[model samples]
Target: LPAPILRLAAVLITSGLLILGCDENQQGFLLTNRPIVYLGDISYVVYLAHWPTIILWKSVSDSTSLSIFGIFNCLLITFKISIVAHHTIEQFFIRSKVKAVSIVVSLIYGLLAIGLMFNVPATVNTSVASRAASVDVAAAIEWNERVSHNAYRQHRPCKECLDDPEGQRMRGGYTGKGDRFECIWKPDKANGSVKILIIGNSVAHLAISILKPVIEENFPQVELVRLYSMPACRPTEVVQYVCPPYHKALPKQVQAMKPDITMIMYDDAILFITSSKIGQERKILKKTFNKYKV
Candidate 1:
């Protein structure tokens, strides 16, 4: 249970396993196996590519969990890909005959990356004026500038935050505020700011961080935000809710806190058992904010 005991147990178990691995035939089989040796040769390549491959696979499949067999199959597929790339892409470029072709390929890849980094759309939308009504170009520019700074020093892309059409719409900026809960030196304008309460599922988690800085820049007058969310706990007033008991009591708690503008962000996933009641939730939200209207 303790750290030192856990370490000792792990070492003992590993030592026992190593001592038990006395089968020379098993070792010889692995050493001589053609497929195993082939995979071993490109293990480093598989190491380099497997993580990104798994991430891409998860994203494309929209899968949160994979079985043991599924993981094995995924890794097998990745190994196959690694072997192919090692022969075709990596070795082909290294050959003297393909040196110029490699340069051209590299240039094309570089240009494509540069285009995405600058958000160069493949097709231009000519409706400038109507689109301008929707986007905060200045805020977007500021976000792009601060993206690298925001990623905790490691260079990472914020495509979902800055590039996506859905993401742009969600950055509507906080229109509310409240009293300082924890900041050390609260500004004098804090009391004057509109208090915002965001209640939803894990979607609120993304909305919270992504929207915070943009809201601060857009509404200099408003400064307070409170977010409460759980992964599967969609807001609903139905009799059979899968939400935590604490979460079920949050509406009454919000009534007591008296936020100025309450945003009821909900997952719109279709469900037969329990659905997030957006309209009824909106009515509840109205009632919560109405207390502070005076």
Candidate 2:
């Protein structure tokens, strides 16, 4: 399935389907079906309503569960929401016959929905106001003066970010080669939180994208410990990578940080290539184990 050929085929198929559907003479069986016709009226509403429900369901439980009852429940819930949305929101707008009002409502709903999805507040409360009111003028002025000198640290687009400003360093916080401090991220908060160290390859990085959000939202107390990784760098230190200057760096970092637990992510396929140097890998890895003193 080359991309170009597949794309060309998709275009041709879509065009053919459109051409076939343009006929008033050839009424389709699906279009004539009672259930489908009912669904067609609220199809857009179903699509809109289902996404949030699915996201919620996934966050709470297994998204890929194939149990028949689970599938039925998901569909039933989505259908019920779609019915409500169609009758109340969708049909109300259509009957009102105000395209401008509909567009405005749509934009407002979309923005609010997107905000809530990202855990943004829909309304400000007393706590927010209280915090703003509590800021002292003297402290603010002092902070402003401090910012005047070390302004580069406040890089725009990522200013005062998460990850410990104090402890962050590159090469998994290992002091090696050039400064890799900016590349490494440690927790600025969660002083009493359990430390977790994660090291791995590209796949691991993708997992981190999903992980970082969950940890921030649910386990904010836990510090994300050493996160040393590059595209092809193996925890076994048998692969060559261009970044982080990580050759023989993991053991020293592990001893230094003393993470509560260490997690390693790697591509098993690379094992074949690494197998060539298994003896050296064993020796290097054994040193890490011995230092752990477990």
Candidate 3:
């Protein structure tokens, strides 16, 4: 549908819903019921928190899809959180004399200050040798900078790039690279940069890291663009916590960059699926690939 038609349709639908909701003549039992009224009260809070809850669930489970048990637990948790937020934060903001905007800004700055204080040591990129040299005492201090001694840490965060303990041994915890999931790598502008979009999950990151030197040496014109890489996420129709952002951003990136090539590297099949859903997932995956392909 066109923009006007879509807007008209949305208005009509909303108006219809409003009319039905306000209808005194019709049976109001469902709308007036305590449970329904309570849900209505907390619906906005649920709207705001549901997405973060799902992402947190995915992080905790390390899986894309939820089981029946997981869904029940999620709903239970969401409702509990929503009810609490509705009664406390939501009510306070709605009813308080103090400006909500000012309070929110103050809270944000306070949390930022705390985070900076805690994270400053980890983000410091200077070598132990450099720090040791700065302190002017004649005490012999031996610092073993390499924890896992894995070369992969030089490319990206070993935590983000590697999954196994064996690979992790090479990575000393997470490098600052772990904090970023996406960035564009620009080759030297003097050589003439060729934009090649590198996308998909961590495998794509690994692939580019391995192949990057070869590209720079052989294909001197190629510039790497890392758009998105979320674990257990791919360009597919299957509803995972990460897929929506990937899909939403792809077209915008494509439009903006107009890359000469778009390379997708991920697991061939959906991360989580039943035997029965494989065929359906395969079709959806194919469709998504077709849609996103440049």
Best by lDDT: 3
- How well does model 1 score by local distance difference test? 0.50
Question: Candidate 1 residues 91-172, lDDT tens each?
Answer: 6665746678868789999999998887666334445545677788789877665442233222211222221222112323
Which portions of model 1 show Cα errors greater than 4 Å? 1-28, 55-77, 89-136, 141-227, 230-294
Residue 195's lDDT in candidate 1:
55
Task: Give candidate 3 misplaced runs (Cα > 4 Å).
Answer: 1-19, 27-31, 98-294
Report how far residue 5 has shifted in candidate 3, in Å.
Answer: 26
Q: Any runs in candidate 2 off by more than 4 Å, and if so which?
A: 1-20, 28-33, 62-68, 99-294
Q: Which clashing pairs does model 1 show?
A: 176-194, 177-194, 177-195, 178-195
Give the per-residue lDDT digits (tens) of candidate 2, residues 149-184: 233224311222344433333225544343122223
lDDT of 3 by residue, 154-214 (tens): 4453222333332122223221233224545554532644555556665555554544544
Q: Comparing 2 and 3 by TM-score, which wins?
A: 3
What is the lDDT for 267 in model 1? 45
**Ranking according to lDDT, highest score first:** 3, 2, 1
- Which ten-residue region of model 2 has the weakest summed lDDT? 268-277
lDDT: the better of candidates 2 and 3: 3
Candidates in order, TM-scores: namely: 0.32, 0.31, 0.34
RMSD of 3: 16.1
